[model samples]
Structures are given as structure tokens and as C-alpha cells.
Target chain A: MAKKTPLDPAAAFRVPSGLAELSAIDPAGTPIGPQDKESGAAALADLGPDLAALQEKLYAGATGGSEHRSVLLVLQGMDTSGKDGVVDKVLGLVNPAGLRLASFKKPTPEELAHDFLWRIEKQVPAAGLIGVFNRSQYEDVLVVRVHDLVPPAVWEPRYAAINDFEQRLTDSGVTVVKCFLHISKEVQKERLLARLDDPTKFWKYNPGDVDERGYWDDYQAAYLDALNRCSTDAAPWHVIPSDRKWYRNWAIGALLHQKLTELDPQYPPAEFDVEVEKGRVAAS
Target chain B: MAKKTPLDPAAAFRVPSGLAELSAIDPAGTPIGPQDKESGAAALADLGPDLAALQEKLYAGATGGSEHRSVLLVLQGMDTSGKDGVVDKVLGLVNPAGLRLASFKKPTPEELAHDFLWRIEKQVPAAGLIGVFNRSQYEDVLVVRVHDLVPPAVWEPRYAAINDFEQRLTDSGVTVVKCFLHISKEVQKERLLARLDDPTKFWKYNPGDVDERGYWDDYQAAYLDALNRCSTDAAPWHVIPSDRKWYRNWAIGALLHQKLTELDPQYPPAEFDVEVEKGRVAAS
Candidate 1:
């Protein structure tokens, strides 16, 4: 008999040993099914409506007062690894009315004044919405570690703090899906060159992106440390191969689709007599 | 000779006397140009690309370190009066990358621990982004006053506090555009009934919305008081008649388009020699 495939997509790319080297994973690898770009695209297209329907159920359940569950998709990626593209393609599959997107840029003075998680806690999706953090609390460790923004003693403890924080969120009905969009350095260079070649893309081509490219090895090491330290049972980190945008989008979408399906959010039973309300409305 | 039309949309519906009663403005009034729905839609369509272009300039200028301007569109409206619809239609005209949306729901326990504006302050758009607040700080006065969530002594001082807060935002690079979506009780009733009749929209129809309908008079009074007290030179409030969704959407689009045109954010010159960079990129 064929070996049973893991039902949980999280099983495939999860940093299981908590010490998986980032360099071991191929940025162009397609770890899950569909084998090729066309099939992967087809699978994603098939899952779109299912995802939308599940979102509606989650929304209905929240409003109907039967369920208070929500999901937070935390995306951490290098420049040109298709974070925004994933947002536009995958999360964009659902009703945007129920989706909240928070992109964490550099910390403002006020944000810097508080603990790193203060701003993040405030932006966590309220009970029924799917919250997408384009870049999130992980930056506290990732960027801060790379740039020496804070001393090692300050940034080091945050891994445990983040685990505790995410655990609390899970306890309070939030399922955290953290994804690291892993891209090869060569692919990033090509993407950057493409941005330079195209004028329309120039708006997105920041000189800082090129500067950050120089720190690629440092960022990868920082990311590996973060993944190992913080990937808990409650919020496991998934390192997705992102050199192929199609596979990356599909993988994330498929993972979200599986998670929502597992959640099985139901449309709540009517609190009032639906038939009576229908009758009243018809009479009115 | 024909009287010169007011080029600024703010001139028409800006709470002029501050005592201009909510009851005095017709919820169905078409105060701006187009007399019909098609014309209003056409106007909105015409303004879309202009708005997009202005947003691009604002973003480009911010990145290029030449401009630091941003706009905050604060939308306050009754339930079923179309705040989200306006967000979808009007504010959706710009690039999502440049737009940040913060929807202030019922305060979380942590949010309650701080001053009301604490969470709000964290969500304000940074330089070069348009921040849209759906049901913003005004709620401290509006819902808190109507629902008796806090003592009058607690909520009353908030009007002045809000004016001060907005003044500070304006003193910085942020331009505050506060809009009150004004719709009649009759229109609200029709909207509520429509939601009841359509199963597809049931997710949006909270039973509490019907209960809130009973508080119509109190809400209007709360809105009027808030509008009168908070409209200021830096952050004037525009009461948009929202009985017609199309007109509301168009009026807001036109207003934003006009405001952005007035700001006329310019693209900053390249920080490095463009020709040299292009040569370097080509050589690489």
C-alpha cells in the first residue's frame, strides 16, 4: 500500500526539528502535490470558492454569536519573495470585508517606546476576521538581530515571549499560521534587476531593498534562528519555497484552505425563529 | 451669468454653522454636481485614475525623501448607512499599498486599559499613506454617549479632546478628512428590511442592528452633538447624504480627488545618479 500522505499541510514544511537549516530547503522546491505549475494553478483555483465559503461560515458564526474563532496569517519574507503577491492572489480569494491586512513597517517613535508586541496585540484580527500581517512581530527578532537594532540580550528573550504571546492568542480562539517565504539569493537578484528594467515597477524598487540584499546571508541566519526558537505546536512556522511564485501562492492557499476546513466553522443556528421572521418580513 | 460653482466639495456639506442640525439636511439631498446615479458613477470613474496618480506621487515622494504628507479619512456613520461600501467604492480608488485601513471595533480589554485614542494613535497612517478609519475615535462620544457606556463626565470631555487630537494630527503632516454619512431613519429601515429579505446579506445583519434602530433619535442627537463640537478648521466634518449609496460614494471620491489635487504631491528626484545605476544594473 502507498504510504498515507499527511492530511495536515503543516506537516510537509514545518520546521519539525526546530533546527532545520534554511539552506537545506530549495527555494524552488514544490513540497506538496500538483507536481507542475499548471496543476498547482488548477488546484488553487479549485480551492478558491471553498475558501470563500469557509470564510463566510466563520463570519456568520461570529455574527450569529455561536463562534468567536479567527485566523491570523503572518507572512515573513525577503524582498521580492512575493509576499504582496500572495496577499493579492491567495488571501484575496475570500471576501475582503472579513479580511484585515496590517503591514508593519519600521517602528514609529511611539511603537519603539513600547514593547515590540504592543502594536501587534492591538492589530490582531478581532474574533471573526482573517488578519494578514505582511511583516509582523517576527521582525523584532529578524531585523533587530540582523541590524543590531537592539542588544542580543534584549532580542534573545523575545523568542520565548513570542511563543507565550502566540500561545495566549491560540487559547483565545485565534489560530496563527506563520509562513516564511523562502527565496534564493540569485532569484532575488534577478527580480531586483527586473524591477530596474521596468519603469512601472520602479515605485516598488527601493534602494534600501538593494542594500538589504547585501545582508541576505545574515537575514537567512536570523530567520533560521527565529524559526527554530519560536515554532511551537500552537504556531508552527512553515518555510515555503517561493522562487516559483505560482507554487508559493498555491502552497499558502492550500495550507489556509486545509486549516479552515479543519476549523469547520458552522453557520450558527438562528437565535430567533427564522420562519417567524420570514413571515413577519413577508407581511411587512 | 451662471454663478461660479464651488470647486471645493467641502464647501457644500461641511458642517458650516456647527449648529446646522442633522434634521435640517435631507438624507436624500444631492448637494454636489450630478443630479442622477449614472452621472455620479461616471464622476467617480473619472476621478479614480486621478486619485491613483496622486497616491503614487505621495508614495514616491515619501520614499524619495522629498515629501512626508498623508491623509486620514475618518468615516462615521449609522449602521446600514454604508461606511464599508464607501470604503469599497471611494477609497478603493487608490492603490491598496498606499492605503491603511483601521476599523475600530468594541475595545479589547487592553484597549480599555489605555486612553481611548491609544489604539487609534498606533494605527494612524505613516507619511505617504492614506489611512482610512472606519468608525474612529468619534465612537468614544457617539456610542458611549448613546448607550450610556460611560458617565457624561467621562464622555463629554472627549469632544474637546478629539478636536485637540485631530489638531495634533493636522499639525503633523497628516490631513484629517472626517465624513459623517448621513441617512434618514426611513432609509435605514429600508436597508435593514432589505438585509432581512436577502439571505446572502445575513452575515452583515446582526439582530442588534434592529435593536439599534430603536435608538435612532438618540444616535442622531449623539451624532449632531459630536459633529457640532468637533468640526474645526484643521479637521472639518463633511456630512455626506448617504440615502443614495452611489452619490455618497461619488461625493467622497470627488472630495478626496480634489483634496489630493490640492496637495499636489511631487515625485522626488533620484537619490543616486539614475544613468550610473542603470549602467551598473545593465553591466551586472
Candidate 2:
């Protein structure tokens, strides 16, 4: 028996080789829109055809009715790490009816009073729907660990609790793909400064973001903990490099396209005879 | 002003004339195979370019971040009457991230305990997202009224409640398009019987649907009341003669295209232009 080699963060994860057999284009390598297009709109324009075909597949998978599979795509990342952009781009390929997007922020007083996962559970998509968590349960680890918001003992158990929660979803037939958009600390500082300089974007910035930045190393350590503990075959974590928006979108789109096509739901078998239909046609 | 006619069951209200537009083809056309030369699929194949253009328009509207306009598309009809099909076809046009779909079913214990509109509020899409309601709050007027599930005094108030709901959504800049897929009783009978006779479709049929059919006249009256009371400048009803599935798909697709174009959201004033460099663009 051969021992499997551990994954190296520096190496690109091998793209599943059989993906090309599923569709005409590789979502991962495909630069949407005109090749040299610099604008988001231009890039988005390039995405239309692949997105449309993917949406058709998604809708067919959803409405075929026999399959009970659900999917939860979780995007977790630092501020301005392209989580929103990922939702904006990758979900472009899905049927909105089949998708749910939930963005989590600081817990409200009511939310804090309950178990951490309470509000998160309500947002889960029912069978045949895809739920996207812009920020998710792992915030308990990332935020609480960095800010020391909860006493260590209270927050520590949450790492295990979340793992179990996601495991349950996967066991119940949810294709859970979690991505952490990794950006350099220098990038974060630049974005925060930009937010402050622009009045129109002032609403998006906070003095608190800088405070959080002071603990960047702490958050990364916590993230490493969560990822190592929760990466199961049923729901694996893909670390998306965020220095490039195009690459991030392509990677996430490829991941989702791969998972959905694997579900392969076809129309239910027809029961009525065409000859009977011909008879009715003749009588009519 | 012209003198108003007194209400009469036989002739007081009119089905919107827009339904006739769908009949430019046929109200009772059959489905065609993908490769068939004269098939409906062949005609719809041309929608690809139209759909791609619609995607660009949708992304443009959403990014503008304007709160001045919103749009909600509501789909309602009998079992197998093509409500799901319409959603599958038309919603495929918009960017999925900018769209939301809420499917209403039997009121949960929590929902039944409140004003009928309570559960609905949480499901309303935020501004910049197109919301589609598969079945909707109109259930109080349609189902509860048809089945006498609630007393007249209880369910009757819902008509006004529903009107107020639409008024608020519109006042807040949400354009509402409600569609009822209208198929004659004989066509419905054929569909229902098809479901009963087919093993694959057995899961979709409900014994109660047969029970409900006994009250077809009552259901029609209920839909009439709901339609007349709820249709307003803010949210008008489009009745689609749905005996022809292809026409239903096309009509609903056109209506959505029209509504979103009317919404016409533009990009919000530039808030961040951090060098606006390739992927490195940030706020500062």
C-alpha cells in the first residue's frame, strides 16, 4: 500500500481531468468576455454563454424533481477579498430559484442569545436549492479568535460544532464547497485606505476594520485551524488566491460546475404511450 | 367618466386582452423536439442572443445600486400548468445573483398563526435583486377562499392586505408583475389524468387536487376576485393562456424583459477608483 502525499499550499490543486468531458469550455481557464477586457462589465460580458449553458443545466437538475440533492457554497475571506465578486460571478451560472445567498455580519443581540448556528440554519436552502453563504458559521472562529469576543472555552467548542453541522449537510446530499479568498495584508490596507478617501464608499468602511487588521496574523492562524479540521471528502475547502479576481471567479465557477454536473439529473421516464396520443390526435 | 356597470358574476370582469398575444401562435400547441426543423425549440433557439443581451442589462442595473426601483415577478397557475416551466425559461435570462425566487406552499404552523402577510415580508428581495414568487401571498384569496379554509371575514380582508403589500413594494421602487397561467378545464383534466396515469409523475399529483377540481367553478371565482382586487398600477396581472407551453414560456420571458428594462437601474456614482488597476483595483 502506498501512503498518499499531503497537499502542498504552494502547488496548484490538480484540476479534475475529466471535467472537459462534461462541457464545451473549461470554466477555470476561460477568461470571460473579450480577452483583453479590463473592466468587470467586459469580463462579465464574456461570461454570458458559459453562464447560460450552466444555468440551463442547473434548472434542469432542479426541476427534474426526482433528485433531492441540495448544495451549499460557502465563501469566507478577509475584507475586500472578492467574496461578493465570487457570488456575483459564479452564481451567474445558476438559476436564481435554485440558489440562496446569505451574508453574515456581527451577530445581533437576538442572534447572540442563541446557539451560534441558529440563524445560520434558517438560511440553509431546502432540497433542490443551492445556498451561498457570503460569510458563514466559521466567523465564530475567525472573528471570535481574533477579537477575543468569547472566552476561549466557549468559542473553542464551536470549531467542532461547525464541523458536525456541515458534515450533516453533506451526508444529507448537499454538495458543500467552501472557499477562503486569501489576500495579502498589504492589499487589505490599500482597500481600507481607499474606502476612507472616498465619501461615496464611506458607508462600506469602518474604523473597526483597521482594528481587525491589527490581528491579521491571528485570523489566518484561526483559518488554518478551521480548514484543516473541516476539510472532508464530502465538503472540501478550496483556498482561492485573491490577488487576481479573474482567477478567483474562474476557480469557483469551475468548482461549482464540476459538482453540479456530477449530479446529472435527467427528465423522469415517460409513461404514456405515443400510440395512445396518436389515437387521441386522430379522434380530435 | 363613463358610468360603471354593476358587478355581475357572468360579465363584470374581463380577462386582460394581453393573453391574446400568446395566441399569435397557438394556445394549445404541442411540444417539439430539439432537432425538429419547425419545432418551438427552433423558434426559441433565437432567444440566445436576446438572453445574452438581457444578462448584460441585468448586471448593469444591479451594479448601479439604485434603490429607486425594484421588480418582482409572480407566477401562479394550476398543477402542471407551466409555472415551474416559466420560471425555468424566463429567469434564465437574468444574472442569477441579482435574482431571488420564493416558492409559497401550505402555511407553516408559525405562518398560520400570524397575519397572512407575515411570512412573506422576510422573503421580499432587497432592492437591486429581481424577486420571483412561485406561488405567493395571493394564496389567502385563492386557496383559503376557494376551500373555505378561513372564514369570509378573515380571508376577505386579505384582498386589501395584498393590495397594501403591493402598494408598499411599489412605493419602495419595486415593480411587480403577477402572472396567472390560464388553461381551460378540459386541458387541466388531461394534465391531471396524465399525472395519475404516469408512475414517474405520481409523486407530483395530490389526491386533494382531484378534490379541488370538484370546485373548479369556485376556484375560478376566487381567482377573479383576487385578480381584480390586487391588480394595480404598481403591480398588474398578466394572464397567459397556457394550454401552449411554448407560448407561456415566450410571453413570460418577454414580460420579464420588459419589466427589468422599465426598471432601468444605472451604476451608482463612482465610489472607489483605487488606481482601478487590473485585479488590484481598490477603494482608496
Candidate 3:
């Protein structure tokens, strides 16, 4: 077997080539963005306006007579890893009109009748919108594998299917940004305990969460396999340290801001004579 | 024609019998809950722990083999009336695992192939869950009527169809709470302008919003018709004054809190003997 070369910090955060082990990356380490909490929060606030602006341009271009391109932010995390918080704090900065938030729960009987992605494909954001999948197609591999919902023969081929599905999305003008919110078992335990301690937080305290905690190693292994197999250049996965809520929010926000800035979407030019329309409106 | 009896404040916020003109309701008025913003926020915070506890009990009862009952919060509002905000601020307080958030956008070709309710029924929450519909089946009537997407004969009967559908859900263990976030035409224009002024808010600004504004009266009429026809004792429509964001969030939160409290779900007893399970665990 050929020896694998070490990846830079950026590459380290993402899945590396060959058999990548999630154990190599620290869930508590901030590989990208500010190391301190205050600075991380400040950075997130600074990027908010730019992200909002860029998202608008993308929305306008798609809605107007111009090329339509959009971004899909897929979030996957263990229980209490702040996926919901990320959606509220980071993605919430953008205009809700152009932002489509889809939270995928367990598959329904009808959804089970079809392929796993059947329900997901329907929720994809239209041209000029930002689609945020609270939990996404990746759950087919992660949760399904962890729970032994299907046989290996059923789920083993999903990696390639996911890659192909994403590639098609990319080819059709959607930018797919996947993030795995990594939190240590200790952090998760603390969060769970806090929920139990506060009466107001009781709604969030599920007994199932405690049961699932026992399968930590199994889930990590499943995630490692997924990252190694499905993290292609087209839609690579970013493993974000989520122990610190501030860093998690900042990193995801900055990552999205960078992606949108790179896309540099512009407002579409007027299809008709603007001056004439302006005059007509004024007279009316 | 007989003279319609005057309604009390609570009944007034709800649709009155007869024509039930939208023009009669004051969008700026806070018909229920705290009269002021500071008090509303405080009251919402005060109810947090109770709401959370009630929701947890509801979830636990369903999951633990007790009588299963869930709440479906259907939120409908015109552009800029803060339907998304209600989901975030009011509903976001609950645990995401037990909460299902579904945002309905423009229907795809596949969705259009079937009846409008087909797509909605799929997204209904399972037992032990609270389902929040950002936009819902009501759109079939509101937007369809406004745009003439369907003929009068097609859209006309849908009012009764919707009434029947909701009645069926009520017949099941589901408690449906429908809210229409009512805002003035002037307020919407102000919000649109604010989005345009802030670059970050550009993503939220849709030129089509202005076009839709042209059909303001038509939408109001459609909403009035839906309210008068569909507000049954099973699933009542609450017209919320949404011009104030804080009050809107508080009102919806309070409303949900009231409903769940009334349900008063109790956690189920252990299926197995506690002492035996404890002994087994200790032995293992």
C-alpha cells in the first residue's frame, strides 16, 4: 500500500484522500477561523451583512432574467451538536424569503416506498435561493447505518449514489456545502445534562438521546466511512469543531460567506428600458 | 339580509359570522396577550419552562406507548408579515428532534401532478412530534385564487375540502392551531424598503413582492373567505396582529403554550419493572 501524504490544516478539516480516519481530527480543535470565542463571534457578525448581500444577489439573479445559481448547506451532527443553533445564528442572518430551511425527520411510510432521496429532491431551493437542509440525504448513510436500518448491501452503494447525486446538483448550478458539526462526547454529555437541569429545556431532553449515546463509537466509524467515500472535490465535507458554539457558528458562517463571495453573484440587468418604466411609474 | 351581531375582542380577532371583512380588523392592534412589547417578551419568557415541560410530556407520552397526541401549528402570512420569525423565535424554543419544521415553497412539477393536499399530507408530523408548517395547504386557496391558477369551480370547492381535511386531522389525535399573521399594506411596503436599503437584506427582496402587492385587496378577500368558511371548532383560525414582531412571537408562543397545557400529556409508566431493569443493568 502506498503511504498517504499529510494534509494541510484546511485539508485536515476536510476528508483526506485514501482511507481517512475521523480520529485523526480533534472535535475540540478550531482548525479554521478565530481561535478565541469573542473574536469568532465578532468575525461572524462582520460577515453577516456580506453574506446577506451576496445571497440577495443570487436570489435576484435567479428570480430575474439572468443565470440562476444557488447554494445548499447540508448540516449533520450528533445530538446536542448545535445544528439547530447554526441554522438560527449563522444562516438566519440571510433573508428568510430567499432562504429555505428544511428539517428532515424520520422517513414516512410513503417516503420509505420510494428511494431515500425522494423527499429531499423535492425540497431543493429554486434558482436564486439558499437551501439549508437541517438534516439531509447523508442521514441515509449515517443514521441508517448506525441503527442497522438496512443491510450492508442496501447502504453500501449509497456512497456512490450520493456522490453522483451531488455531482448532478453541481452540474445543474447548485453549490453543495456539507458540514459535519463535530462535538466531543464530553461536550454532548454536558449539554444533555444542562437540558435536564432546566425545566424550560425539558422539551429538548429525549430519552432516546441517552440511548444513542452508547453507540458513539459506531456512529464515529460510520461517519468516517461516509467522509472518506463521499467527500469529493465537487461537494467536499468540512468537519467543524462544534464544542464551542461561537466557533461553530463563526466557522460555518465564514465558510458560506467565502463560498458566496467566490460565486460573486450579480444583480441581473433590466430586461426593459428602466428610464421609460421609471417615467411611466412616476406619471401614473 | 339580517344584521350581524357585534363580536367581543377575542371573537373579533377571529372571523365573525357573515362576510367577515378584513377591513374591519385592525392589523396594528394586539388583541390578546400582553398589551406592550416589554410585557409581552417577559410573559413569553415566563411561559417558557411551562411550555417546554408540556411539550416534553406530550412527546414522552407518544413515544412511550401512551395516548398519542401532537400539535400542528399552521402559520400563513403575506410577504414580510414574519411567518419565518414566528417559527424561529416562538417555535424554535422546543427541541428540534421532537419538532418538525416544514417550509412550503413553489410546487414542483411532481407536486403539481397530484392534488395540492397530497404534498402536504406527506409532511405531517408523526406521533410524539410538533409540526410547524411555514406555508401550508391554505396556499392552494389563497395564491391559487389570487393568481387564478385554478378555475373558480376548481378552487371554490377547496374551502370545504380543506375544512374536511382539517376535521379529519382533528378526528385523529392531532390538535391543529392555525394562525394568520395579519399585517397592513403600509407595513409591508416599509419592510420591503428596509430590505432594499440594507445590502445584507437584499437576498430577501423580491421584485415579485411588489407585483403581488398589486393584488392586495384580492388576497385580503381570499383570506377573509378562507377564514369565514374554514374556522371550525376543531381547527380555529386566530388572526394575529403581526405588525409588531415581538408581540407576534409572544402571541403565537402563548397560544401554543395554552394548547399544549390544555392537552396536559403525562409521561407513561415504565413498561418493565424498574427494580428488575436496575438489577439487570447493575449486573451487566
Candidate 4:
């Protein structure tokens, strides 16, 4: 028998994780087990320890480092996909100074008149800051796609534009991590019903959500297309199966920590003479 | 001699913690502690544990309850006050999903045309969320007072409008915690200088801050007046001394947690049928 070779880390990295499979409109079945040979589950678990270490690195870096390369995490997910929960948990790990969030919804008439990206661009983190976008420009893709607010041809061009845009950001040193939380229709229905029954949640139970729910298949198809086209080496999409909130949080946090540590932003190179700093301090 | 009386917690809380006394416009008179203590040292310490607890409560509440009341924390402060640092630290403690941030700046021509509060209203927290405003509607007072943008008569009416707006919110169960990070002019200059001298922080340094510093006396007078008049029983203003970044974080965190815990939004009174919940799960 021929000798079986072991998997190398680089080769393993190239094999798309279950994240990609889940992101597809029609995902192929994969075997699941405690060891998680399945790409999605393993990728999700892989994020844990790296997330913890990166979190510690970020906190220390924020307080002690003069120049920190800030990161912005943008999450776009379907209603039941758990954007809020993901954000709350993942960001809990980073230092507060280094993290901020902007959640975008239906823009007013004034917002509509301006370019779609205008309001979003203003929300990006300045250098050395981390900004998270709960629903980002991809809204131009998913929401716009589902609603047909923009023609197919119009948004078709946007895929390349978005890829270029994200690449520019990556080149400029903005580590952009994007996640699309994927949940099954059955799970979504249960959540919707929960929202409807509770009075406090009645505020969140928009009649519109029901209307939107009818078009679930369309939305799923739209998301798959967006993921397939927009997913790039620069800003890869992690399609998280969020039927489990705990698993989702761990996966997202791990992905973020991995991307940030890879960037490895360093402390400011210039240092002041201690005596001079003291003298300047005294003078002030 | 008559027995000396000791201060109670409420009485002690009123004793000012020697914050203002420690703040001298001149560094020569300011006591240099391990960390910058002239302004924020005491205030931060007071609020730290409370903020930590609030973060945990926010997560616990988010997970267990089907319904949660969203909270908005507005931080309005003078230039040298630690608004950014406070946000950097206090927000550091919470689950990110529960938090959103809006940092109001010079309004665009579009923003200027609308009623000032229109933009702010859109930023308010949704049910079960928390929103933070770096600078808010009080800008109508702070900037207007200093710049004389509107006549006193017009601006004065806003105080009533502001009170009514807040009352409406409290009546609807929206709890607002507003903090004014108070720092002395002397401390402001030291931090501003630190920004100037450090290459990495140079981006944060604006010549405009110096120009504004020239008007320090005018701005301080305006804030004191606004704080006195607008600080209401419903949404009382906590004037946090912010010379020490760590202390400021703690005080602001503590104040917010105390307020949120007091609100104590619980699970809705109506119970969900276990069978129905199970059926919904089964159907999914």
C-alpha cells in the first residue's frame, strides 16, 4: 500500500472550511463528529484559543502602544442569524478603547438621496481604531437584491467594486472581517413566534418581518450569490451556522482575533527620552 | 467636645471626593500621581466595579429574557473631559450586541437643515439595546451658549423641551444615564500636548483644539450653567472628574450599572406554553 501523507497547515488552510459550504445556497452534506473533520465546525472551534490570546494582546496594546492599527468588523446576517449576539460576545474580548460599533437600518429620505455608502463610510474607524458594522454596504447587495431597489445589472458591477473597495482597505491597513450568520428557516420561525408572543418583544415583532419571511428562499439565494461573488482573499466571508448562539459567538470572536493578530500592529517606534518627557511634563 | 459625626454613603457621595480641588489649571500645583489623578482619578475608581457588573448584567439579561429594555447612555463633556476615554473604557465592559455608538460632530449641510434632535432620535436604542452618544443634543446648549448661535430666549425654551422629551422617554421605560466628564483646563493641556508630541497620536491633535483652548473660560462657564439648569431629577447629571482615565472608566461604569439595575427590566409577565414552545421547536 502507498504511504499516506499527513496534511500540512498551508494545505489545510487552502481547503475551504465548512464556512464556505454553509454559505452556499444548496450546501452539500458533510460528515460531523467530535473531532470535526467538517470545515465549518472545525473553523468555528479553531477560533477559540487564538481569540483569547488576541484579546489579551489587543487590551495590552491599546493601553501601552502609541500607534495601534484599529480594525472594523462588519456583520450582515438574516433576521434570525444573530448579529447582535455575535457583536456583544466577540467585542467583549477586545479592549474597549480599540472597539466601536455602528448599526445601520433603513435610511431616511435624506440618507437615501446621498450615496448608499456615504453614511457607512463616515462610520469607519480612524487609524488605530476598531469599528464594527452590524449591517454594512452588503445591504446594497442583500437587501437591495431582495427588494429589487437596484436592478440586477447595477448591483452586478458592485461585486467587483466591493472586492476592490475591501482590498483597498486591506492595503491601507484596515483589517476588515465580515461575517454572514446563516440560520435555517425552521429556527427563524421559532424566533419570530417568540417575538410575537412576548409583549416586551412586541415592539420588535414588526409585521414587516412576517412579510419578509415569505420571501425566505429568495433571500437565501441572494445571500449565496453575494457570498460566492464578493468573497475574496482580502476579505473572506465566514458563513456561520448560527442555529447555536454559543457556537456562533465563539466562531465569530475567533475569526476576528485571527485576522487582527495576523495584522500584528506594533507600538509606535518613536520614543521620548524619559528625562525630556518628565521635563516637558513639568513645564506643562 | 461634641461627638464628631461620620459621613454616610449618601453624605459621602455628596462630599465631592476632593476632585475639583485637585484640579489646578497649572500643573505646578497639580499633584502628579501614579496615573493622571488631577481630574479623573477619584471618579474612575468610584465607577469601575459598577461598570463591570453592568456588562455582566447586560449579557445575562440579554440571554435569559425574551424581552429587555434598551438603555441609552449619553456622555457630554468639556474638551479636556474624558468623553473618548470614558467610551473607550466603560463600553469596554459590555457585550457588544447590547451597545451602539454615535459620535456627533459638525453637522453636514443636510443635518443642519433638519431639527437638531432629528439625528439624535434616530440613534436611540431599540428595545433590548444600549446606545451611547459621545456628544448629544446638549450641544444645542453647549455650543450655542458659547458661540451664541441662537438667542437666549430661543435656547432657553429648549430646556423645557429637553425635560419633556426625557420625561416622555422615562414614562415609556427608556432609562437615560448622562455623564459629564469634568476635567480641569490644566489637565486638558497636558493630554493635548501628549497628543501633539506623539507621532501616532498626531492624527488626534487638531490645531482647532488649541484655538478652542483659548476660549476655555467661556466654555467652562457655559458647561457649568448647562449642567446646573439641565441636570434634572429624572435624568440627573453625574459630573465625573476625569483627570485619571482609569478612575473615569470606573465611575461612569458604576453610575450606568447602578441606574440600569434600578430599572430592573424583567421577563414579561405572560408565560409561554411549554407545549407550544416545544411544538414550535418540533415544527422547525
* lDDT (10s digit) by residue, model 3, range B86-195: 87567656654467777898999999999989999988887878898999999999999999999999999998999999999988888998999999988887787666
The residue pairs that clash in candidate 2, if any, are A32-A46, A33-A46, A194-B283, A194-B284, B64-B266, B64-B267, B64-B268, B70-B173, B70-B174, B70-B175
Candidate lDDT scores, in order, read 0.83, 0.64, 0.78, 0.62
User: Which candidate wins on DockQ?
Assistant: 4
Deviation in angstroms for A192 in model 1?
2.8
* Candidate whose lDDT is highest: 1
State the lDDT of candidate 2 residue by residue for A109-155, as single tens digits. 99999999999999987666778998999999889887788899988
Backbone clash pairs for candidate 3 read A56-B203
Q: What is every candidate's C-alpha DockQ against the true complex, given to 2 decimals?
A: 0.15, 0.16, 0.10, 0.18
For model 1, how does the per-residue alpha-carbon lDDT over B132-176 read when each residue is reduced to its tens digit? 899999999988889999999999899999999999999998999
lDDT of 3: 0.78
DockQ for candidate 1, C-alpha atoms: 0.15
lDDT tens digits, residue span B1-284, model 4: 11111212112112132234323222222122224444445544444555544544443445455545667788887675778766656675566656677888887888878877788888887666678889998888778767888789878777777777777776665677777776777788788777756655544444456667767777777666566666666766656656666656655655566566665554343344444543544444
Candidate 2 local lDDT, residue B4: 20
| Candidate 4 lDDT by residue in tens digits, A1-284 | 11111322212222253334443432112212123335545554455445544544444445445444557787877786788766655666555555667888888788788877777778887666668898998888888889999898888787888888888887876777777776877778877777755554543444456667777777877777777777777777756556666656655655565566566654343243434543544454
Worst 10 residues of 2 chain B by lDDT: B4-13
Docking tier of model 3: it is: incorrect
Candidate 1 lDDT by residue in tens digits, A1-284: 11222456788878767575798998999877777889989978778778878887888788765688899999999999998888867875676567888889999999999999999999899887889999999999988999999999999899999999999999999999999999998888788778777654565677677668778889999999988888989999998999998899889988898788778887766566556554443443
**Candidates ranked by lDDT, best first?**
1, 3, 2, 4
TM-score of each: 0.74, 0.69, 0.69, 0.63
Task: Identify the leading candidate in terms of TM-score.
Answer: 1
* Segments in model 4 whose C-alpha atoms lie over 4 Å from true places: A1-83, A95-176, A180-227, A239-251, A261-284, B1-70, B114-116, B147-161, B193-200, B269-272
What's every prediction's RMSD, in angstroms? 6.2, 9.6, 7.9, 9.1
Candidate 4's displacement at residue B111, Å, is 3.5
